[model samples]
Target: MSVAELKERHMAATETLNSLRERLKERRLQLLDTDVAGYARAQGKTAVALGPMDLVCCRILQGHTGKVYSLDWTPEKNRIVSASQDGRLIVWNALTSQKTHAIKLPCAWVMTCAFSPTGQSVACGGLDSICSIFNLSSPLDKDGNIPVSRTLTGHKGYVSACQYLPDDDSRLITASGDQTCVLWDISTGLRASVFGGEFQSGHTADVLSVSINGANSRVFVSGSCDGTARLWDMRVASRAVRTFHGHDGDVNSVRFFPDGNRFGSGSDDGTCRLFDIRTGHQLQVYPHPQDNSTPTVTSIAFSVSGRLLFAGYSNGDCFVWDTLLAEVVLNLGSLQNSHEGRVSCLGLSADGSALCTGSYDTSLKIWAFGGHRTVI
Candidate 1:
């Protein structure tokens, strides 16, 4: 080999290293920054557009065989868990972009999977009507393990979402198509309180989504097929703290601002509405560009600073909006790396530095957040 060529290569390598070192010096979370590895191509697709000015695809992790219905990155962003219609729960090592384990469940078409606040456990729910928790501390977890720590049995219908309460690591809340949301004491392994009646009136149809207030352990908001979103302050345990009406169609999702003064809802009517918690009055409504003709807004999340809103649409797109001015800062149209179907779910980490998206196309995509995004 020529010495000049070798010297040139050596110089190139050193330059790349120096550039990366400068970039890493400014990392926000001390996170393991790894680019995603899978480009899920379609049968006859020539090109994919993931938005130009904004929403660049940093990485794509593809492993699910069926529609990747739900996925979430653990608090530390080191591990990710995804559920698919193939009746499998797959956990991945987010850093190396490798599959860690495949958890086989009783049936196919699972809906959601969530990690505990401590990242020590995981819970999954689906069409099977039962929620199961897996302990990550077991030896099996790191070796492609499939251990069911406990099967939480109770719901009469599909369990949509199960999440650990923020203040308590041992407490969980599960919402179901059975028209109810149940709170369970994780340590005691018993139902703590049912929001359906004991604490608040149950929805007439399916309870589609549920979210807890970041500042209050006893407060939460639930959306239902009945076209209403209700705030349940279990601190009272007798009735809803407030009931709100605005959406003309079924409310598909609900999420609270970090401060707990307001909340947001996504509805089938193709609008994401923000409302005042104290007055039960609509504070703002971000509707579809097509004016009710666009796809449904499936999920909505707030930036840790509570100034930005990220909304996922059924038309296979995502939009980043400003909370204060109600303006879309970026309309990340159809992901260049899209699912064969719709993007069913997306989650931003607690600090708002990472975004995890899952879709019927059977894939998960993660995006890095900027500056933890506090109050705009």
Candidate 2:
């Protein structure tokens, strides 16, 4: 080979080596950034901090004259829908802390409320045994009260909880004190499927909470006063596919983990348990130190990544538990400005950036990681 050709090849190899080194350096920096953001999400924060995973009260939404029985955040994260025994369902602008609209129900015993998937409507039900639906764009009456667009009738007892099916807002599921969970088709205003009744192999007592699996919308699980949690398929509502027995008292709340293969339940037994749906086994139980009185878990919510479980107790205590470690990492009740009465319901925002809790004290509190974060 000629000496000139040898020199040219040598220079080419050196340039190639330099380019490879630059790419490797960029990759290392990317990995470091990812590690930091991942740590923040796993620790339930936006940045690395020194304290425990805590939720600071950013807003205390007032105006309800009666107990706030249920609250749900809209998909836009800027609005909230709350139901109260005051016979009103109020939609609030969380960004401005203003009541955007209020609907007066014919029945004053409203218990549960939920925002539809599209954020265009709201559904609520209670002691009237009728689930009422209202459209936000519809014209309001002189009193700023909107008329019910649809009224779902047929539940034999008080409706305890109602939620829209994920991805499909036209359908919803409602649990009732009648010991039944019914899937309703809102568009047709008819019952689509019924899960339990006196003849069905279902809960012997009232069904309190129902959680539909987002991964497979055809399946859902319910917690009942009979001290059991049952999984049912929407197609075959004749009976439950699996029954979980662990809580010694009534299971008040049930929420699906992110993967939808597992679920968490809070019970009157003063214990929160994780159940594996596929294996039909109890994975873990979260129990507090015994005292003279035990607090019943009233509501529960799972984090977006399924790493944390937020549970509200009847004693007005809200706990954030580490799913893998089975530890209470944060206690909102111990914090200042916490609820003074029973926490009836709680929900995590769509973006997982905020949480809202409704209480029997007739108020709702917005909680997040920062102290006094501006709503805007």
Candidate 3:
């Protein structure tokens, strides 16, 4: 074809794409049921302001030579297990900042880790595409190394996240780059159920995070690169129970609210959103201020009362949001002695008395309401 004709065709195609994009945007706006922030404002609602004095960093746990990727608190809330790029999983006493066990991993690219419900074992997975478990009570070898108790294998891609079923250490759930979530039988080291795959109604991209419902063991939510979060039931692995969408970028993390009736998600789009499971509707959006560069949210958690939402960002900021009013209560990252690098992960204690944040700074800081003994 002549250059003139080719140019004309290219311009026509570009115009068509732009028109369709605008139409999609308009459709989304029309489907939104409510503007949550607007409703709150009309009702004269305001969040109780939280300051730096209300949340203080009480302990800094330093030992890892590499960035901390993931962490989980024991059911008792006194202990924590952290996985780092250093190829080691370190179990620490949260109150004392002492390492009780440091097991060298078989794979150095470990991306995620979790503590079993009984606190008797821990599991980790990474580029190896296998979930390896280590029994805390088992005796170490002559070299003082903890041996792998079991390995769950079958994933075709890297395991991105994992969590043990509440009150049941025998079963665990994991999200993977394979675009699926799997429930594993820990004892048999076999797949108990697979939630999504190429032939199933599941995530269309890599699943990055999973949060099992604290109120319902059989139910869980997974965040994916497809810009959606899906609710899945362990008993019905054929399809997701519901899919929630709103994010314009990858959904990086998902966490169940304290009540489990609702869940929150953090995304590469620089927004943290709350969704209701029953109605499959977005309830609120906590957007990062556009003037601040809008760093991607890497992880998120909720206070015990479900009133506060803590979101960690890629630029080393951890903003604590008041869930009801949809406002920033405090920025933990801006406090004294906060993480010096990107906040990679954060988790609230089982009792919600403290919050532990892991960062690319190779350290984890435990923040209590006021001091080490203060409870929020």
Candidate 4:
């Protein structure tokens, strides 16, 4: 090769190298600068104060006496309900964080629970392969007391996730270990439709999680052990709106942003992805550290402020990533002595006033959010 050609190639290589270095440094800054708890320390110990991980944990609801599997907050924000291995659903006051009610179930273990959009009832799905709904308010005495509602069954395996159609409390949907997602007429306790015909349905394997887009009430998404996430329209007949295929491992979670056009997924492959729902094109892929260490992404949440994304990893560490720049916001901390074991679930209030996490440690931890929100 001529000297001139060799020199040109070298310059191109140098430019590429410099660009990559700049991106790496940004990830590092995301790791350091975005640390939520670290910045809180700079301020006095108050509304925005707590020990790195330990102090941040508030009101461990200790009633299950077993691993808490699923939980949901009432739409009114007045109560939160949790399902556990003990086969019970316990209700708590949202503010005081005090237990208010508990109900024993006929099932073996409860896998999922959800609140009706109006906050008047709740549904619990379990290993017994049935979904149960309860009324938050019923024929009260002279004062005011809630009553047990009814049970809806049909799935043959464990129910993984249950979501109610947006703006409607009379209907609901659930994804299951039976490899199908079902829509139910909650008012009549009848199956409205069996999604995904009968051949192990749309998902390649057991469906793990499901989330509905509130902006477009008729659409929802689900992720599965088979390594893909599918979007379905409630108005259609088991037709997949989009199928996302890129993860090298099982997909555990999928959710839509409040805006409704885009969604995100987290997998056992140690990566979180954001995609455009219309064209089935992946817009961006956010990766875990190169160590990729243990490869289990426990939980993920979009900050209420829309400025950040939070994910809990298998190694007991949590990270915050900025959504706009696709940068890491901070390394929250490890679960070590904090939650007991891996963090399995996280919840953020509608107003984004507080955060809650459930883990194998058999407890729930709540974190206070204190970030400034600006319209972008």
What is every candidate's alpha-carbon RMSD to the true fold?
Answer: 22.0, 19.4, 4.1, 11.5
Candidates 1 and 3, the one with greater TM-score: 3
Writing each residue's lDDT as its tens digit, candidate 4 over 78-113 gives 567887777777888877878876776767478888
Clashing pairs in 1: 36-59, 305-374, 305-375, 339-361, 340-361
Ranking by lDDT: 3, 2, 1, 4
Candidate 2 ranges beyond 4 A from true positions: 1-54, 371-376
lDDT per residue for candidate 1 within 1-376, as digits (tens), equals: 9999999999999999878855754442233232111111223322222234245556678888888877776878688888998888888886676887778776686888888878878888988888888887766646455677777887888998887897467888988998888888777677878777333366777888888887786789999998889888766556667777768888987988888988999999989988778755676778778754689988888878776788888888788876665667766555465445577888876556667778887888876633433223
> How many steric overlaps are in each model, in order?
5, 0, 0, 2
For candidate 2, which ten residues in a row score worst on lDDT? 45-54
What's model 4's lDDT at 152? Answer: 75
lDDT per residue, candidate 2, 1-376, as tens digits?
A: 9999999999999899879956965664454433322454688764212133346788899999999989999888889999998999999988778999888898999888999999999999999999999999999877777888999999999999999998778999999999999999999999999988965579899999999997899999999999999999999999899988778899989999879999999999999888889977677788755586988888899878877788998888888877666667777888888999998899988878788999999999998766443221
Best by TM-score: 3
Which pairs, if any, clash in model 4? Answer: 30-328, 34-329
Tell me, by lDDT, which candidate is best: 3
Candidate 1: regions farther than 4 A off: 1-54, 139-145, 197-200, 334-340, 369-376
The TM-score measured for candidate 2 stands at 0.84
Local error of candidate 4 at 240, Å? 0.8
TM-score of 3: 0.91
3 against 4, candidate with superior TM-score? 3
- What lDDT tens digits, residue by residue, belong to model 3 across residues 1-376? 9999999999999999889967966776677757667787789998866777889899999999999999999999999999999999999999999999999999999999999999999999999999999999999989889999999999998999999998888999999999999999999999989988964579989999999998998899999999999999888899999988789999999999988899999999999999999978788999998666689999999988888999999999999998888889899988999999999999999888899999999999999887343444
